[model samples]
Target: MGKLKGEYIILQNEQFYLKGYKDFANERLKIEDYRGNIEHIFSTIRKLQKEDYVHKTIVKCRTKSVPSFLGQGYMLEGCIPGYFLGGDAYFLCKYHDQKRFTSSMWVEEDKQLEEVWKKDGDIENKGVITPSIRKATTLDAKKLATFYASVFPIYPVPIDNPDYVKDQMEENTIFYCIETDGQIIAAASAEINMAYRNAEITDCATLSSHRKGGYMYDIIQSLENELVSKGIFCSYSIARALSFGMNAVLHKSGYSYQGRLKNNCYIYDKIEDMNVWSKDLSALSAGKSALSAGN
Candidate 1:
């Protein structure tokens, strides 16, 4: 991928997708415009790219000063990112290190792996909520911030910014908790990209004492169902590639392994692969529904 004159292009196997902010937004956004509707902008590029090739598509973005929403969630920087579309979903990639250019490109490699543990509906109920699960309200921001601070020391943004999550509390995101005797012990949230028809599972953390008790798994399933009810059928997450406990939970829950974007994020100055994992939640819901009907 390369950017020049305030536009970006990606070349793969002699086929390419390119767009300018002008053409992308029909001249609505100038080069330095701040309010780019990244979703619509990428959809236009994907349309043109498909005109040339039929293979699965992947686009990676490295930039500074991404939209606050993307920045807080994914840690994009320096410039606003260009859009990637048409494969499974769009992702903004954080480069492993700083190069002279703000961005680079990579092929989509993870589509090769098959997933394991297709769960039955019973798996949903099997989640014993020792610390009961509940939807988080705006009032819970401070508590949520505190929980994140204690657990996600590796996150790129300061963990204490209650406003960070506060800004994400619009219709797009649903934050929730696993609480014990009224003290919040664990937390998770799903951000639904209504435009993309998908959900991003993020901010999952449990108190150390609460670990190994399956609360996280229970919370994940519950949140998955919540997204499903709202018509989101696909879910994806970026997590530390080597987090065995999280990987095991996602694995058991039937999320497909889509491989890692090597050295894509920060864990306190040390970079790590933010493993890209996705699940076809629609399939999971359908399978569970069928199993339920049979029972």
Candidate 2:
């Protein structure tokens, strides 16, 4: 995402990614590292809300610390399976603004959520051999930027910039794509958190004409296989709640709906709510898969 002028603090063993004020749609506090007491973290959040007016706060912590945040009025928003070494991770959120917390368009979003929830995680037949999805290298950054620019007028990140895409690849992000006649038609990526053995599947896009061809399913399946090979299988996606196509593809690929983030992101054209979906590929994890087993 585009860097905004926001407070990024690192205190001894603790770190915070406070959502930037310029990105008003996603203004919140994100606790990246919390090795100390819970009260100290909450105190910081309170101070941030009072002085900065952040609309929300999100923290990812182990199950052992869930009660401490919940007692302070934080609600469980979602879970990241296999996020810790041997334990699952949780995302707890507390809202400072009632409007940002409430979903006025829930009724509309509910219909889409229900429809996607019931879908079997199976790739629909498209009557043609699908192009193999490939792992994108830095050489493809410029083309990827051009492709993203064609699909979105605005994004939470400066994805249209080649340097930004290259920088991400150099970091922890991996991009995958489907090509037709030497042209990229659809793409997605996994933002890896190696420290936590987890990744977030995001940045999905497709050419308008190739919508129903199931290219997305291929990309997701490949991404899962890749992560599993890296010994990372805690997969989750933050999809736009109101978008049926994206949500359906994620559900059909074995992700379960955890919860929603109201006014969470500024995507495409406007600020939108996001739905959290996750899948666990570990032996102990339970979920349906549209692709082959042993992910």
Query: What is the overall TM-score of model 1 with all chains considered together?
Result: 0.60
Write the residue-wise lDDT of candidate 2 on 1-295 in tens digits: 4444355655543443232232343576666656656566666667766645477777776799899988888888777666776577788888888877877777889888888877775666578788888999999999999999888876777888899899999988999999888888999999998877888898999999888888898898888878877877788899889888999998888788888877776787877888989888664232334334755
Best by lDDT: 2
Model 2, global lDDT = 0.79
lDDT of 1 at 85: 20
Q: How accurate locally, in lDDT, is each candidate?
A: 0.55, 0.79
Query: In model 2, which regions exceed 4 Å deviation?
Result: 1-7, 13-25, 51-53, 283-295
Model 1 ranges off by over 4 Å? 1-87, 90-129, 288-295
- Residue pairs clashing in model 2 are 121-290
The per-residue C-alpha lDDT of model 2 at residue 256 equals: 83
